[model samples]
Target chain A: MPQIAQIAETYASQIFWLLVTFGFVFFVIGLDMVPKIEATVGARDDKIAGDLATAKAAFARADEIEADYRKRDADARSSAQHLIAESKAKAAKETEAKIKATDAVVATKIAAAEAEIKAASTSAMAEIEAVAADAAREMVAKISGASVTPEAAQQAVKAALVHG
Target chain B: MHQFAIEPLFGTDHLAIGGYNIAFTNSALWMVATVVVLWIFMLGGMKRELVPGRWQAAVETMTGFISNLLTANVGPEGKRYVPYVFSLFMFILLANLLGLLPLGLVGLHPFTFTSHFTATGVLAIMSFAIVLIVGFYKHKLHFFSLFVPHGTPVPMIPFIFLIELVSFMVRPFSLGLRLFVAMTAGHVLLKVLAGFVINSTNAGAGFGLTVGLSSFALMIGISALEMLVAVIQAYVFALLTSLYINDAVNLH
Candidate 1:
């Protein structure tokens, strides 16, 4: 009963202190601490997000660089191949031209050698005709006991040679 | 027991001004002590490390717990009410736990502020006040529709509304009585059981020793339960506050 009665008597003081303490705690935590904690949490989250974005951007940039490098490498390889093909074609054309020039020079030499041989054979034949005519004239004078003319023998020889 | 008795700590001749007892009593001292402890705890835990230390973790855990409680009952819109809800939960929790600590001033009883109906009554009324004020402020006349059940028959509407009204009216008293009764009951039971051990120990030699030891063991068990009760009661108070606020905001 006294406990019940004392509640009313001390009600005002209890409330006053309660208000004072509660208000103090509320403001201290509500205005100060809670917001501070929230800010920290928000900041941590933002840091994580920013770091993740940076990482993603770096990854994308690396990919682009690699692609560019691959393209350049392919271009260099193709150009090298093209250069080899062109040089090979040019070398073949020069070899063909050299062979053609050599063949012309060889054909000219063959023609000159044939003409010299023909001239030499013609002179030999003429010498043989003169010797044959002299020998015939002497044989006739000695064996037949009639004096024949050298000019006539020569003409006869010419005629025989021409007919043969 | 004289544990519940209040006496003036300072200001001789029983400081009274305008018929109001303005004496700084043991209750006031304990209340101040509770507030100071809270202040130190909050201030000490103010360091916001990426990896929180023990003190910081404790503060964050407590803040998160209350945050979750509000969100669960009051939904996303209850974000603004965190400070008030956090204040009530921590106040009641600390008061309950502190009273159980066996720390008392010379010639004064160890007590909890939550064990007093005056304190819990004020807290409950304040929570209820927020509901009414915010509800009326938000919903205005439609706030009365909270008593009406949605899609009720015309005949049963009156009965349901009456029941709802009564339940609403009893919210503050129920809230106050729940904490007071729980704290007071547990404390009284602990006192009685401890008394049993003392009395039994004083009775005889061998038999007294046996009874005393067993009772002491039982008392320890009860003390553990009382600690759990302290936490639960704090949670329940905050949870109900959130629920009531939700009811007020989102009506029937």
Candidate 2:
């Protein structure tokens, strides 16, 4: 009851100061402090979100670069394969050409040898015919006790050579 | 008992201005102390470091806590009242806790501001004013329909409306009285218990010592409980304010 009685005497002063203190607090906290705090929180959140976005972008860029590198690597590998295949095909073609050139040279050499052998055989035949004629004439003369004609012997050799 | 007394600090009588007394009193001094401490706590705690320091974290936590409270109670519209609500909560909380400090040094008499009806009553009325202002501004005449229950029978409407009106009118008084009574009662009980300890110790030394020890222990326990009550009462006061504002804004 005394406390209650004291309230009347004390309330005006209490409220006067309460209002002053509260007004100061309301403006200080409500207007000044709270907004700053809210802003800090907002800014922190934004920073985090921005950092995450940057990280995500970096990841995406890395993935793209990796893909590009893989593609280039595949291209290089395929080009190398193509070069190897092309060189192999060229080598095979050159080998075939060399073998053909060798075969042509062998064929030419065989023809030349054949021509030389023909000439030699022809000369030997001619000489043999001459000797045969001389011997034939000598034999005929000895048998018949008469000289043989050269012109007739020579013609007979030619006829015999042509038939052989 | 002398702790609760209000003697003018400046003059023989309270200074008057425009037919209103504005003399500074014990209650006013403590109220100013609460405000100053609140300012220091809030401003000092805000460094806004990416990873906050202890004080910054405290400030941020309090801000977030009040934001959540408003969101839960008053929805997004409650965002407008964050400063007011935050101030109210801090004012009561600091007032309660600061009272527990041994501020009576040399010749200074420290008092608990929230324990006074004038302080709590003004806060309660201000809270009610927000509800009324917001309710009427948003809902106009439909604000009065807050008393109308959704499924009430027509015959029972008058009775129910009367009950609702009475309850509605008593919100401010209840808010004020609850904080005032709880704070006053707790302090008074502590004082009385302290008196008992002194009285028992002044008796014959042997019996007195035993009684003094036990009573002092009980006092310590109760004081701890009172600290809890102090925090709880601050929370309840703010929570009820938000709830009242919710009822006004949402009319539910």
Candidate 3:
């Protein structure tokens, strides 16, 4: 084979060129290019991890804010309910006291009115008895032709009103 | 045989260095071509995009494959040798595949330098040299213990060590010969099949239709197989180099 036959002649050149070319590849590619590629990959991984951590922190912050908002909402609702209950109780107590005072005033007024009516009715009854007695005495004198005294007339009217 | 012949380029056959014929040959041309192609391939990776384009991804994939291979075989210390092994792997791989390029249709013959034992022998020696340098530098005389197993019977130790020592010494020769023989054989088979097709076609229409057509089909299949072999041989070379480095690094 020529591979065997030409080896003595070609080995030197082949080795020389192989070293030169292979050395270029080793320095330019392996030493220079590889590290750059690895760095880029490593940087991307770091950036991804950083972004993920940021997102996680933001998510946790949002959860905390939501919890705080819910707690404040519950506090406001309970306080408003307490205020409403306090106002209702105060208004009800004020209403009960006012009603009791009005009731006492009305009762006093009604008692005064009943006393005035009794006094007026007693005077009217006396006037009505005097008239009836005067009429009775005139009728007695006219039939028998006898004069009647005023006092006797009052006494007779009183006895008749009492008997009736 | 002509494919494998070393013809001087630019009429440099008259060139000499010291007493040796240092004529720039087709093999040297292919070696330079391999470097140029490799540099162009590596240019994609220099773009340094976090989101790599397809070209960059291809570059990264090859580097990553070698990087991972070294890491697995030789552990963390293998990281220091990535450049040498990467250069070795890509050089041999490109040489092997470039040789199989179907450029013959355009009246160009591609030489597979790896088919020459001298070229592969030098590569194998480089790897073997690294192993020796690392093993001795790290372990001193303990590196000799690599030839002896932990559970060896004292009586059998001498024989076992002899076998291991011989096998260890055979690594470079076997490594170089494997690649050279594999590449040369495939090319030879393809050339022989091509001869069959051509000869049968010249014989007559009946033979051409049968024998030539069958050989042509067979050549196509074998060409594809050669492509696979080209890749496999490159990987095997790099993998064995890493494993051998492992033995030196780990002393087992």
Candidate 4:
């Protein structure tokens, strides 16, 4: 086996080069390259975590905004409802007051017309009595050829009207 | 055996220091190749995008795998050892896989440095040394208590301690030997099967049909298995190293 037989001759060379090359690898690759790769991986992880947190905050803000909008919408709707009800009540009250005033005016006009009719009826009865007295005086003169006074004729007509 | 032979890339005496021949060899070439491959692989992930491409994801998966392994084996304190363990794991894994690169089809032989005990022994020693340094630095002499079980009877303590001490001392050798032997055996088996296929085909058509075809099929299967072994060995080396570190850190 040359490996065993040639050891005395090759050991030095092998050891020398092994140390030189391995030393380069340890310093250049192990010490330097490894850390850089790990740093890149670490930075990527941090970015992902940060982005996730930002998304979570944004989502929460959106939910809050939606809730606020809904609340305001409900408030606006209720205020509109309150305004509608208030105006409806005010219009109804105004209508009732106008109807009451108009009702009182109409009642006064009707009473005045009734009093005027009663005065007209009283005058008409007086005129009819006078006409009846004159007619009676004429009729009595024609039938008996007696000349009677107007007041006596009126009295006779009033007695006959009382007996009838 | 020729595959494992380590010929100096330059002449043998080209580079020597302190009287030790440190000539650059094929094994050294593969070590450098492993580093280059690992660098390229790591470069793919350096794009540093928030959404990683496939290449970047592959690199991150490997690092994350090692990180998780340390966390599971060595607890929180295991974090400090990630670079060392990651380097060790990737180096060994790439070396093992590169050796099985099927470059033989192109007439290029890939050397598996990890198959050599000298290479694996060095890695095992490094891990063992860390364990020793961490244990003593943190616990002082109390690190010796690692040999004695927590609630041993006084009479049984000495015998148990001896067993534990020997096993503890065997860790580095076992760690190194396991990877070396596994890699060497698999390569040797594949080579021997290739030899059988060639020899059988040269012998005759009947032998070639029976032996050569079967050996070739088995070689293909073992090659697939070797790929799996390559990954498993690297994982085991890292896992055992982390577990050993766990002992030094937790004292259990």
Per-prediction tally of clashes: 0, 0, 0, 0
Model 1 CAPRI quality: acceptable
Model 2: residues with Cα > 4 Å off, grouped in runs: A85-164, B12-14, B45-52, B104-108, B151-156
Which wins on DockQ, candidate 1 or candidate 2? 2
Which segments of model 4 are wrong by more than 4 Å?
A63-164
Separate DockQ for every predicted complex: 0.37, 0.42, 0.49, 0.51
Question: Across residues B1-252, which tens digit of lDDT does each residue of candidate 3 receive?
Answer: 899998888546567677667677788889888888988888888788878899988988888888899999889989888887888899899999999998889999899999998889989998999999999999999999999999999999999999999999999999999999999999999999999999999999999999999999999999999999999999999999999999999998
Candidate 1 lDDT score at position A160: 89
Residues B93-157 of candidate 2: C-alpha lDDT, one tens digit per residue: 99999987755656666688787888899999999998899999999999988998899999999
- Chain A of candidate 1 gets a TM-score of 0.56
* DockQ result, candidate 1: 0.37
Error in Å for residue A115 of model 1: 17
Q: Provide the DockQ value for model 4.
A: 0.51
Candidate order (TM-score)? 3, 2, 4, 1
The fnat of each candidate, in order, is 0.57, 0.67, 0.77, 0.81
**Winning candidate number (lDDT):** 4
All candidates' lDDT scores?
Answer: 0.84, 0.87, 0.89, 0.90
lDDT of 3 by residue, A1-164 (tens): 99878777678888877777777877887788777776776687798999999999999999999999999999999999999999999999999999999999998898898888888888888887788778878987888767788778888999888999
Docking class of 2: acceptable
Q: What is the interface RMSD of candidate 2, in Å?
A: 1.5
**Stretches > 4 Å off in candidate 1:** A1-5, A70-164, B11-18, B48-52, B104-108
Question: Model 1 fnat?
Answer: 0.57
Across B118-159, the per-residue lDDT of candidate 1 in tens digits comes to 888999999999999999999999998999878889999889
